[model samples]
Structure formats: structure tokens, C-alpha cells
Target: MSVIAVLALDGAPGHQLTAPGLAFATAARHHHPVAYEVRVCAGPGFAGTGGPAPFGIEAPWGMEGLDDADTVLLLGHEGFRAAPPPGVVDALLAAAARGARVGAVGTGTFTLAATGLLDGRRAATSRRHTRELARLYPRIEVDPEGAAVADGAFHSAAGVLGGVDLCLHLITLDHGDPVAIETERQLFLHLHAQAQDAGGAAPEDGPGAAEAAYNAVTPPGSSLEPVTRWMEANLHHPLTLDDIAGRARLGVRSLTRRFRAETGLTPLQYLLRTRIQHAQRLLERTDDPVERIAARSGLGTPANLRHHFQRSTGTSPTTYRTAFRALVSGITWPERPEQP
Candidate 1:
């Protein structure tokens, strides 16, 4: 029964505008107890969006729609860098002052930052625009590469595709893990879930977890940093639960709980997924043999890698590599004969 105002300024991105609604709508369709009442609202005579997905829209509510919203989600538009429309910042301030969760997508971060809600906090936008965002808003801590970021009640992300990751993360926060997973499944977003890698990167977008993604969302100088870094450094070696706990200097039970709370995946789950993700990058970027890729990714053997890769990606290693290479490089690579 939470009211969500999806505020679209002139020229909002299509997916960022609709991805939240689509997620909640499907949540209800699948008996997930749709908790949000979403309204697509725009100011009077709002101009249509221009980039990526261009379309005109008519909505039933105006700025007034934000008055009762439990959440105000700002969607980016063509003139995202320009100052917000008259009364928009005031309306947003009023909503935030009332304890409503304010969210932003892509350049919408600019609008949110204009309201000073995101001052001194990290906000994310398209990696392409991170430089502009940082230059324009020096007070804001901008994370240009995050797929999505959640610090307290404020959230933001880099792209329209990231809207799904952002929404699902929100759904997970609002409901529980099960409900969010079900809703994502209902929405047919299994392959793109991008939960966590202990490094904070989303596999499909942004760079890999080679950077400090997990700690980025955790408290400043998290205790988990050293262990997480050690885990990432040793993914090529067979690691055990006890080994991880020893690295963290915590008992296994405590480690499990921390993993669940921080990353929404247990340590083993995170490590396995990270390994598979690493294998994926190898398959996509390298001409290495599957055996070597498996060993390096810590999957032990080719058969083991294949089993999990199929389960996680719905495609064989070879097929995944071909498709990804073709998509990213605009050139198809036929399979090379395996090295003995």
C-alpha cells in the first residue's frame, strides 16, 4: 500500500521510467503482495524524453502526486544537466522532509543532487557521465561505476538497464530475498540479477568486482575488507569455508550472518558466483581453453565449470563466449580446437 511517485521530467529514459512500475506490476501479478502503488506523474505540459527510448507520455498526476508518495523516484531526461523545473526541487525537499525515500536513475541524480539531498553522499550514474557528474557536483561523492548503490534510504544507479538491478535491490530491501527473487523471476530477469561479488560490481554491467565494490556499500573501512580482498585474490585456489572464516578472523557462523546482511548472499554463494563470473570474463575476453579457465576460476574442472555455468547463465561456456564477443566486439569468433 506504499504510494510510489515516478516523476518523469522532460525527456526521461524509457526503461528508468517504466522499470520500477513493471517490476511492481509483475510483483502483484505473481501474488507477491504488491506493496507499492505506483503512479507515473509529470508536471503539466511535460516535454517528452529524447535519448535512447524516445516517446511521449501523458500521466494523471502532477507535482501534487508527490505529496502522499512513500517514495519519489526521479527519472532522467534530455536536459538532465539543466536546473530542475520550478517547484520541482521544493516539492522533492518537502517529500524528503516527510521521510519519503527519494530515488534517482541516471541523470536524475543531477536533479536529486540539485535538491541537496545527495550532498556528501555517493551517487551513481552512467559511467559515461561520471566525469560530468563529479565536475558539476563536487560536494557529492560520485561512484561512476556502481551498478547500483544503497546508502541509508537513498539509492542511485548508472543506466536504464541498471534500473532493474536498482528496483530488485529495493524490492529485496522492502520485502525479503524470496519475494524479490520471485518478482524478478516473474519479470524474466534471472540472467541479469547481478546480486553481489563481495566487490560490489554487477556482472553484466560496470567492470568486474576487481575493484572495491562490496566495501563501497559497507560502512567506511569495513572489517570485512581484508577477508573479501583475500578471497578475491585467491579465487584460483580451492578455498574452504574454514579458510574464509580464518581469513576474516571470525567463526563460520558469524561469517555467514555477515555475508547475508551485507551482500544478500552467503560467503560461499558469493564466491561461487564470483568464480563463475570470472570464468565468464575469461571466456568472453580470452582464447584460453576451458580446462585452464575452469582451473583458474576455481571451478576445479571443465565438467564442474560447465554444470554451474549452464545453471547460472543458461548457456554453455562456448556459446556464452561467442555471443558475448560478437555482441561487444561486432565480430563473431568460431570455436578454436581445444588445447590438449
Candidate 2:
């Protein structure tokens, strides 16, 4: 099990700390034989946010816990508007020095950036704070809408609810795409149902926002859509830019330039992402055999599939499938849970 230490300082955003805590805890409970051991540590003299209602949280560990953790998550609070306190920066710097994977949620990047750990690194901070973050840390690339960004050993999220995205993304990192897909299906469907009942689509894709963002940059007739469709259809067959350009009736130069403009990725890179995305869907939603899945995703051999799948997600395809199947069928790990 990976050991995670969450460093909570005074005035910490309540949800920022609790979101990761609950996500890992729920994952541990549902999967059993816990995939992680989570420690919630407080900085010296930390009294939390003091709450609208009084409460007390006794810390069993302190900054020292961060030293032993495989992953250290920094929780940022209102106090982070200025530079992080000296102690907080020290603990984060030490964790990074020891080669630990580090991350932040929402404005927590402020603290991580203060340590100089994020210099020349990409990070995500809350949209409201994006300009300030950029102004403060000119060396750190702040992506406003990016779900999460991993620069070297640092991972960061852009907003409050991006916590769920961060957790699911970490699930993708720790388990595999298949596991991540199943977890996303569960969480997404629940959230979607809640949003529908609340009379609004989810904030990420509510009404015209997604389309507006898409159109604001790339108008219709851009090279991305057609090439993307072609890749999806011909993924099983060997593909080439010449063939794509011919099918799309565009010159290679036009196709390449426009494709990159629309998607921010080269045509071949987009093809690979599409293939992997398809394979991930298959792994999560189907009982198809692995060999068939490899062929269906245009990935060809099982060895190739395993190689890229593990490379992208950190776990074997079979392990991913087993975990996914268990989760979807309402079965827990180790021993299957009862199915109705």
C-alpha cells in the first residue's frame, strides 16, 4: 500500500483536505486490502479553520510524517493568499527533496509554488486565482480549466470540485485506466443524476460553455474532427498521415497544422490517444477477451496492449479488468461482494 501524508495547516480549506481523505478512504473500503494508508497531519500550532461550529481534531502525527510518506498532498487555505508560512514551505521542500510525489488541490499550488518546487513546472490553480497565481509564480504554468496537471513529481488541480477529478486521475495513475474508468462511471453518474435533479447540467459541461470554449478557438471545419473520426474508424488498420490527409481531402501540411491547432497535438499523437481512450472504454464496460480488445482498439498484440496500458496507467490490463469488473458488478475485492 502506498503511504499518503496530507499536510494540513491552519485556515485550511475544509473541503480541500476532506476530499482527498474521503476519496482514498472510500476506495480503500470498497476495494479492501487497502490500496493506501492515509495520514492527515497538521502543521505546528494548527487549529484548523475554527469552523462556524466548534470542533476539535487531534493530530496523531506532525510534519515528520511527511518525511516517510510516498506521496505528500499540501492543503491550502485562505492564509495561502500570501506566501506559505515558513514551516509549511520547509516540509514541502523536504518531501520533494526526498523524491516523494507531491500534489496540491485548488489554491494549494500557491504553497507548492512558494517552495520553488513548481518553478518551470505546469500546475493548475482555481480559476478565480489563475491571474494572481500566474503573476506571483511567473515560472509556473497555471492552467485554468485543466482538470489536473502533473509536472515532474507534482500534481495539481484547478478548482474545488476538481478534487474528484484529481482523485480519479490518481486512481488512473495508481491502478489503471480500467479502474479509473469504473470509478469515474460511478462518481460521474451519481453527480450527473444529482445535477439533473437540480435542473442544471454539470458545471464542467453545462449548456454552451463546452461548445463555446471549443468554438472560441477552433471554428467548424477545423481538421481535428474529421481526422479524429477517421482515426477511430481505422485504428485497427495501420494508419498514416497521407491516408488521413487523402481521406480528409487536405494537404499534409494543412492537415498537420490545423490538427495541432485544434487539438494541441500532432495527428499521430491524437490517434494514439484515441486508440488508448477506446481501449480504456472497452476494458471498463465490456467482458470481451483481452486479445479481442487489443485488436478492437487497433493496438494489435496483447503484449503491445499491456505495454502501453501499463505505461499510461501503472497497472496490468488483467489487473485493471479484474478491478473494473468487480467494481461494476458490485463486488468488492479479495472476496466478491453480493450481487443483486
Candidate 3:
């Protein structure tokens, strides 16, 4: 069993702290029996978090608790102005030096980056902090995309909500894809599970793919299949209502009408988003030149790719790819459980 130390930083997001713990705990509860032993660590004299769910909970251990962890998970928050305590950073850096997997949730990327451990490494944090994180450490690769990213010893997620996705991703990495998919089903989160499946939706948190919380909510519609497949094939091609409709074997007007009715997005809107997804994947999984990536994903040119890429994800494709390339490679991310 791996020992996980969850760094209970002051002002951490409520959900960010709880999500991974729940994931690890649930894994421990069912599949592997003794999957992980989690320790909540805080600095000396640090009072309770007091925000909400995890805030009121007392830390079971202090800085000393981190000493024995095989993996350290840092919860993030909006307190970018306040740097992580020097001692805490020292401990985490030491842990990483010891070959422990260092993971950060959301804004916690700030803390990890501040340690200089993630210099030139691909990491992610919430979209809100992308510019700030980069402005502070120009070399560290910061992905604004939502999937939790892991490169060598460092790992990071895009935001508080992303914490859950990272947890599932880690579960798949630590345990296996099946276990993670089962857990995601229990959480009622369809996106992560779909991601696990080979034919799942795009990873950009698209219209039909992203949702509120993981719940067994009815899916948006079946048009997802034809739409996603079409996007995958025609990413680099100029997509239109007629183009997609022809691919899906429906009339342009009917395809447009049905896709909008089902997904609440026009065909062009859906096509643009799907193209962005392909571009992101290409950026993360390949070393293709920017122009090549734009051509391959149907974004037209490097300029067009950068333009739409930034608009959707708040960062350049090159920057996102540099940081995330290591994550999705040969990785079959987990998927949602099939409906009964």
C-alpha cells in the first residue's frame, strides 16, 4: 500500500482537498483493501481550515507526517498572493527528491512551482491562475487544459473541479483502468469514465462531455457518437454543417437541427470545440511542429490554431503541449461505466 500525504495548506479549496482523499479512500474501501494510507498534514500551530467540508476537520499530523509519504497531494486555493510556508516547501521538495510522486490540485500548482521543482516540467492549474503562474515562473510549462497532468515526478490539475478528474486519473495510473471507471460510475461523473473509454468524448470539457458534478445524469443525447467521430476524422479539415452532416449520413439541415436540439450547440460551434480537442491532444501526445499540428487538427494554420486554442483554453498550444505531452502518451484514461 502506498502512503499518501495530503498537504493541508491554509486556505485550500474545500472540494480540492476532499476529492482525492475520497478517491483514495474509496479505492481502499473496495478494490485493493489497503490501497493507501492517507495523512492530512499541516504546519505547526495551524488552526483548522474552517471553510466548509474539510476546513473544520483537524489535521491528524504536522509537518512530520509528510516525512513518510510515498506520494504528496497538495490542495489548491485562490490565495496565490501567499506563498507556501518555507518549511512546507522544503519538505515537499525533499519528498520529490526522494522519488515520490508529487501531485498538486488546482491553484496548488502555485505552491509546487514556487519550489522550483517543476521548472521546465509540464504542470497544470486552474485557468484563472495560468497567466500568474507563468508570469512568476516563465519556464515551467503550465497547461490551462483541465486534465490532471503528470510528467516524471510532478503532477498538476486545472482547478478545484479538476481535482476529481486528477484523482480518477491517478487511480487508473496506480491501480488500473477498470477500477477507476467503476469508481467514476459510483461518483456519477461521466466525463472521466468516457475519457477512459477509447471512443469517449474529447478532453476539452466540451458541451456534451462536461457536466455539473459526477452524477448518473442522463446523457445529453446519442448525437455525441456521430459528432465526436466526425470531429476526430475532420479536425484539420474546414468543417461545416454540410460536412459533418454528410459524414454522419444526414442532411445538413437535419444534422444541424438535431445536433443543436440535443447538445444545445450549433454544428459549427460543436465542430470548433471538437477541433480544439484534437489540437490539444495532438499538442499533448506528439512533437509535431505548430503548423503541422494546426494542419493535422484542421485548425488551418499555426496562427489560427493559436488564436482558437488560446480563446478556448487560455494558453498557447505549444505551452500546453510541452507540459502535457507526458501525460496522455500511451495513456488510456478511464471512462464512465456503461448504463445498465
Candidate 4:
């Protein structure tokens, strides 16, 4: 099991504790190979099993428990920006050195920041606290508006609800999209389903939310829609810029300029992302070997697939496939709950 330790300090916000706990607890119940072992580990002046918060949690472990965890998570506290207790920073550093993932919820990024793990890494905290965080930790790259960001082994979420996004991201890391999507349906569907509806026709665009975030100023319709659609449909065939330009009925320079103007990414960049997305789906849904998946996803070979997959996602293809398969055998999470 992947041991996950939630570092519970005095005054830590209760919501963050419940957020990840709810997410992984549900995953353990539903997912096979039983992934995460979540324990709330407390610090000085700590309350017993009862956690701080709206849920009235009673944590089972104390600060020492974090020493053996695979991941250490920090929750926001009243004085989160204040320096941590004597051994807290050392413990966090020790965990990071051992390749354990460290994450924080809300202003808890400030607490993690104090430990220097977030230096020169991207972190997201509540927009309300960005300036103070930036001033305090000038080396850390803070995204004030981000829903959540996982850069390398360090992860940060903006606020209370951002905690949900962070937890989902972690689930996706541990079990891929199918399990993560089911967890969403169980926990957040009724509340967020409508917000998720702001998408365009699938053939015209590949996933609207990501595109919008990458290039919010772009217009709705792309002038090169047909070419993009063709690229999406033919990802398995080895493609080059000349092929794309020919499809656009334009010279290389003209196609490049227009595509970049219409979408923030270049033609090849978009193609690469599309191919990677396809590979992710296959890894989640099929038992095919990495070599076959690479060929099907236009990555050409296992070596090539590993190169791009690790670049895009921080983990290798084999690891991703293992995590995905561990989540469920063949169960696809329902799109909506059945009416009672």
C-alpha cells in the first residue's frame, strides 16, 4: 500500500484533512490492490484521533508516523506561514530525499514553502495569499489562480475546493482517469457536473477546458478545424509538418503562423498532446503492452513512448499502466448516479 501521511499541526484547517481522506478512502473501498493507506499524523499540542475540523476527525497517529509514509501532505493552519516546529522541516526534507511526494492544501503551501521543497517549483495557493507568499519565498513560482498544480513531487492547491481538484489529480496519478472519474461522480458530480458542461463538439476540438486555459483569448472556432480533426483521426500514422501544411493548403510558414495564432500550440505540439492523451486512455482502458500502445498512439516505439510519456506526466509508461490496472479490472465509472 502507498502510505499517505497527513501532517496535522495545531490550528490546521479541518477541511484539508477531510478532503484527501475522503477521496482516498473511497478509492480504497472501490479500487482493488488497495492503494493508499492514509493516516493523519499530528504534531505538538495535537489532539488525539479527532482531527481539527468540520468533520470532527480523530487522527490515529502522531508526527513520527510521517517518517514511514510514501507521501506527506500538509494542511493549512492559522499561522501556516510561521516557521514550523524543530523537526518538521527536517522530516519533510527527509521524505523528499527518499522520493516521496509532498503536497499541500490552501495556504498550507506556505507551510511547505517554509521547508524549501517548493523552491524553484510551481505551487498554487489561494489568490488572496499570493503576494505575501511571493514576498516570503521569492524563489518559488506561485500560481495564484491555479485550481491545482503538481510540479515534480510537490503539489499545491489553491483553496478548500481546490483541495478536491488536488485529490482528484493524486487519484489520477495513482489509478488513472477511470478511477478518478468514478471518485468524482461519488463525491462531486451533483455540484460540478454543470460547470463541466462548458465544452465544444469533440471532433472540432480535443478537450475544451485545457485549450481555454492555455489560450483564453482565442476565438471559439479555429480556421484550421478540418486539419486539426484530421490530425486527431490519424495520430497512428507518422505525420510531419509538411503533411500538416499540405492538409491546410498553405506553405509551412503560413500554416505555422495561423495555427499558432488560432491555438497557442504549434501543429506538432498539438499533435503530440493528442497522441499522449490517446495513450493515456489506452493505458487506462486496455491491457495492451507498452510497445503496442506506443505504436497505436503514434509514438513509434517503447523507447519513444517512455521519453514523451515521462516528459508529459512525471512517471513512466509502465508505472502509469500499473497504477491504472491496479484501480479496477474492467469497471468503467458511471457517468451519472442511477435515480433512486
What are the models' TM-scores? Answer: 0.56, 0.55, 0.53, 0.54
What candidate 4 gets wrong by more than 4 Å, as runs, is 47-58, 189-340
- Full-model lDDT, candidate 4: 0.70
Worst 10 residues of 3 by lDDT: 211-220
Model 4, position 142: C-alpha lDDT score: 84
- Please report, as a residue range, the 10-residue window in candidate 1 with the lowest summed lDDT: 331-340
Candidate 1 regions off by >4 Å?
Answer: 189-340
TM-score, cand. 1 vs. native:
0.56
Off by over 4 Å in 3: 50-55, 160-162, 189-340
- Candidate 1, 1-340: lDDT as tens digits: 8788989887776666778888876555433234578998995447775555478878888899999999888887667778889989999899989888888877788888898888888899766678888999999889967467876678887654537677877777776665576565435432222333343543442222122122112222456767876887799989999999998889999999987776556788778876876786688678999999999999999999998877665567886675555445542322111100
Best-first order by TM-score = 1, 2, 4, 3
How much lDDT does candidate 3 score?
0.66
* Residue-pair clash count for candidate 1: 6
Q: Rate the local accuracy (lDDT) of all candidates.
A: 0.71, 0.67, 0.66, 0.70
> Which tens-of-lDDT digit does each residue in 168-271 have in candidate 4?
88888876665576566445422222233443212221111121112111223557878877887899999999999999899999998886776666778768
Clashing pairs in 2: none
Clash pairs (backbone) in predicted model 4? 49-58, 49-59, 50-57, 50-58, 51-57, 51-58
Q: Which candidate, 1 or 3, would have the higher TM-score against the true structure?
A: 1
* Model 1: how far residue 36 lies from native, Å: 1.8
Clashes within 3 Å, all models in order: 6, 0, 18, 6
